[model samples]
Target chain A: MINTEKIVEVQNLNFSYGQVNVLSDVNMSIHLGEFLAVIGPNGGGKSTLVKILLGILKPDSGKVRVFGKKPGTSKSVGYVPQDFSAGRGFPVTVREVAMMGRALAGKGTTKAEDKDVVDKILNDLTLIDSSEKRMDDLSGGQRQRALMARALAVEPEILILDEPASNLDMIGQTRIFDLLAQLNKNMTVVVVSHDLTIIPKYATSVACVSGNVHKHDEAEVTEDMIHQSYGGVEGCPVELVAHGHPHRVLKEHDH
Target chain B: MMELLSFGFMQNAIMASILASVACGIIGSLVVVNRIVFISGGIAHTAYGGIGLAFFLGISPLLGAGVFAVTAAVIMALITKDNKYRADTVIGAMWAFGMAIGIILLDLTPGYNVDLMSYLFGSILAVPKSDLVYMFILDGMIIAYILTWYRQIHAVSFDSEFASSMGVRSDLIYMSMLVMSALAVVLLIRVVGLILIISMLTIPPYMAERRSNSLKGMMIYATLFSLVFSLVGLVMSYFFNLTSGASIIFVSAICFFLSLIYDRVRTSK
Candidate 1:
């Protein structure tokens, strides 16, 4: 039973990076408890769409809203950026990073209840054992999980992640998607991923963004959609491996 | 050491070292973790413009540098925050531009032959009693700011984009951090001078980063390291007639290298 409550809405959004148009006349909406995978080619404005949704980047001309309010004005969104290791070598413990989520949610961790929330998040993410360890000491998978723990600690209604498993191994990627599947039971989950095969397994919907955005209400990744988003089969040689079946996701093309 | 402590000058120098250590220890950790050492260097060098302004206006040189440093920091923060790709080039230009202004202003000062070496290097032994009061206030302000906004600062330093998404006002926090760095530069200018300030601001925090698991712990450890380096460097300078600022930086550099070697050997084992 999907909730039809709209959590994110964008209307005629046009964005550019100094005249180089990234997103043009883009319109999309996300509902509550949605597991949306934003997929596109490199330099196709996937991350830009994520940033705009998170209010990190404002569209040049458009109306964007999250939780029925202007993006970034609401406190119900939790985001994990693409570069989770941006703070590598920073002197911060796993527990402290999770606690940052609490702080950001306008709830300082001084109270026992707040601390308990953070601890529970860390425990749920299987980061309890390494809670005292520095972020630099954690493996890539653990670091990804730790960042997830931080995002979850916000107790958000919507969770947005940009390339959460880009640096992980196959097993690690599976683990992260599985974790997202579990998390999607309660919150709206939006992810920007290049892993086309893994996305159909978990995402309830897909948004193929190039300079324009095409929203699919179903999880199925079609040949025409990929070809259109990637500027036809000649421009994109995408070999998608779904359920261990190695096959081209696009139409037949030259060798 | 006891005999030296009995002297007023020695007392002032020790006090100055402790206050300088406190500023560098707290602010320096943020500087190192954020990888903004170069921006800090820019602010320190830009402070010379303020020093020259002070001489020309017949005001306290420290005050001039403090005002100039904070102003430069705000400008740097604005430029770097928006135009990250070209930050280094802008900082380099500002660095040279600041020095040029200071040189011109000092040259135009009528009948005042300022000892350029004292400001370029440091004159810790010649620090006036009044400067100590300013240093104390600055340390207090830095501590209070950190305590008030620890979580925000931590978030911004770690992942600013994520922090911004979480309503942290990362740009504001980043600017504040830069302003604090500028103030820390003012605190250190008397102990290490403008040129040697970056080492004092970075080396101890870099060492502390490896040893601590939390930002607060790193700050404490860095502060302690800075205190030790300053005191030892001061004593060595007094006994050997060496430049105090250079001696302090040399001590920090040696320790930094030794820490590196120690980590490498331990890792190999």
Candidate 2:
């Protein structure tokens, strides 16, 4: 049963790209302070749904609400997109990028306060050392942290990240998840990841998106569910196997 | 160089170059960082259509180019935003088509003897006082816009998705930036001409990108470099009797290549 203290609510959402249906009658809810993990096969509309929630894309039909407001209208939601470039090779420093997070919050704020907020966030994210470095000069994991620092700098009630640690190593990924876990104590965290190694252990709830959405509060993802999840999608068998084991693929192969 | 200041036209040319650099530096940094050089290029060439339309209607070519460039910007923004795969083909077509329109329009206007070469290259030495006034106002507006919206522009340019999540209108900012690029093209065309506008827009920003650590720094460096290149080229043209526009572009090209060397040498060292 869905809880009453929902931070995000998606009701009867149906999205299509011209002819093909990306999502159909999708329904999901995220409660406050819950670490929600959105997982799915590639092209299963996982990122699309996130984009809709970020107000980057508008759904054809249905509703996506964050904090009782439309996705784009909500200032309390922070986002770190997949492969976020801080204007790569274009002289945007980590500090400057992080400061951009405070641009919208509290009008007519002093520059010193903004700088202080950005500095603390960078320190918390362990990005203070490289705060002065150009975005392109940072390693993938460092860049990912810079993006996270930027998102967290906004001090959002709900922070969403699409494949936040895809560029990071397992150690780096663990550190990020630890950081997310710490943040999730007070703030809601929504992470879109394909890596199943950490999700089963860390996520308070997991939502598997594949044409349809299946939310599990216990965060256990069975191999059968993973296999059956990709049943509707074509040419996803290889990718499914790539992420982990597949019971459905063998079943389909036998057929 | 001493006698250059004695001539009113020379003084005006120097002042115009400084103003042009200001516009180019700010807008050029955005254009480069946003990866919309091709769009700017298309606008530069497509602006010719506006110039031609202006000639046909007996209006100022700058007005026509401004209108035409904005229209081109709208079209470019639409397709490029929705479907990026078709952007190249669309840009290529728009680029040639705009130039062709301008040429045809210039051909149709019988009584006026508009120097097509001047429009193509530049007439920096012949920059009228009225045009400088226009550039001055535009330069002020541009600086103010950047200063007022630097943070928002930073958000949109780097991670628009994050920006939108933070309640910034990334799409509007992006479109506005493209339109501003068109405006920059209009301002620079008289100083450098349509053919060399991209150079003014991209070269300084490209060089400044490596030297600076922030967009503001990049913009400042770009402005300084643009001014230096403009003056150096202007002086070279004045002494050698070369075309001012080509000379400026020549200076930029040289600096670009030299910066490349500097980057390589520093990296290797």
Candidate 3:
């Protein structure tokens, strides 16, 4: 059974970029404590959907609700942006960037507890040694973890990452997924990724967004669903191959 | 240099330098970090239209420029904040238009004999005590705004999307910073003319960014750097009998190249 608590709900959501139809009638419901992987092809509105949920971009029509309120209302949703290098050259320290996550931690004021929280996150992410180092000075993997530490410092209920491991290699991607899986045990996690193989391994629920959104619990994902969701347009099934908790697999979907 | 400071005009120039340098320091770090240097240049140049309008109406030309600059800054900020590729074309068009208006208006002013070169290139030595008050007020405005809202500015500048997710009102903060920079550019005109304001706003901050670890550190260090550059430029102007604005920019440009060399060596190490 799905978790009873509804953390995110999207209804009839439509968004566009100057006449380009990005999202059309996208509807989905996310339950609490579920590691949701939002997968799709490139330029298929995955980032756009996440942006709407983050309240950075508004929809052309329809509603986006988080915790039974507007997406930006709660400030409980932590976000890891896609482009880690957006403003990296601005001379801000890693700790300073992480502290930005604390903006909504305590009613717009930093308490002693907030500092403790940041310190713990830095240490856990193995970023304590480089906390004072400039953001641009860190390696790509280190920067990603730093950003994750920043988001986790918010102590959010729902954490969303936009293609967290895009530029990373297979090993790097698995490392990130491992971290996300650990984080999901305590809080709801939503990751938008093009890595199809991660669905069965890490995600509790899958939301495939390609022009539209289709939500599938672990048991509902099938070869036809995977094909239509990802490989459908190319007249093939975009097969995902990975392993985690043992589950029965359809013989036909097996590659 | 001491003899130069003894004169009223030089004293006023020094005061103007302090006021403008501080404003540029605080505001310039933002301009460079936010990558809005080109937009600021656009605002500075567009302010020339205001100067022309003010002259046409027989009012204070500086006041006209301030109003025009702020307006241009806000508009340019809105248009180019997200779309930077279109910035040069938009700013270049406005730059040419502003100069055209200023030239035509100055031509129309009956018996107007003010040296147009002074406005094009700055004549900091000609600034009077009265203009210092405006500089101080504008300086106060920029400082108070940045200090009162440092967290918001810091968050928004580093990563606006994350800031917005944290309910920082990133767009509002972005607009306010751009508008504040517009006002700062207005005050800066007395030191460096509209033509040279971009370099004045960016050079010290660019050098400071390479050394400092935080935005606050960058702002403070950049201010000191600007102060030194202006002082050295002023002294060089007195000795070489060159245009003060051009000399100041020359000093800043030289420091900029040197900082690049230093950063290259350090990073290579």
Quote the lDDT for A227 in model 2.
44
Query: Residue by residue across B1-269, what tens digits does model 2's lDDT show?
Result: 68888999898899889999999999999999999999999999999999998999998888899999988998888878867467989899999999998989888988869888777898788888988988888788888889888878987887777777777888788888998898899899888999999999999998998899888899999999999999999999899998899999999999899889989999999
User: Which has the higher DockQ value, candidate number 1 or candidate number 3?
Assistant: 1
Q: iRMS of each prediction in angstroms? A: 1.4, 1.6, 1.7
Per-residue lDDT of A190-247 in model 3, one digit per residue for the tens?
Answer: 9987666555677777777777887776634444555455544331233342222113
- Candidate ordering by TM-score (highest first): 1, 2, 3
Candidate 1: where are CA atoms >4 Å away?
Answer: A107-110, A219-247, A250-255
Q: What's the number of clashes in each of the models? A: 0, 0, 0
Q: After superposition, how far is residue A59 of candidate 2 from its true place, in Å?
A: 0.5
Work out the iRMS of candidate 1. Answer: 1.4
Backbone collision tally, model 3: 0
After TM-score superposition, the amount by which residue A43's alpha carbon in candidate 2 deviates from its true location, in angstroms, is: 1.0
The runs of at least 3 residues in candidate 3 whose Cα sits more than 4 Å from the true structure, single-residue gaps closed, are A107-110, A219-255, B81-87
**CAPRI verdict (incorrect, acceptable, medium, high) for model 3:** medium
Please provide, for model 2 over A104-209, each residue's C-alpha lDDT reduced to its tens digit, 9 standing for 90 to 100. Answer: 6543278888888888989998889999888888988888888888777778898899988877888988988898889987788899987866775677777778
Per-residue error at B236 for model 2, in Å? 0.6
How does each model score on lDDT?
Answer: 0.86, 0.84, 0.82
- Number of the predicted model whose DockQ against the real structure is largest: 2
Best TM-score goes to which candidate?
1
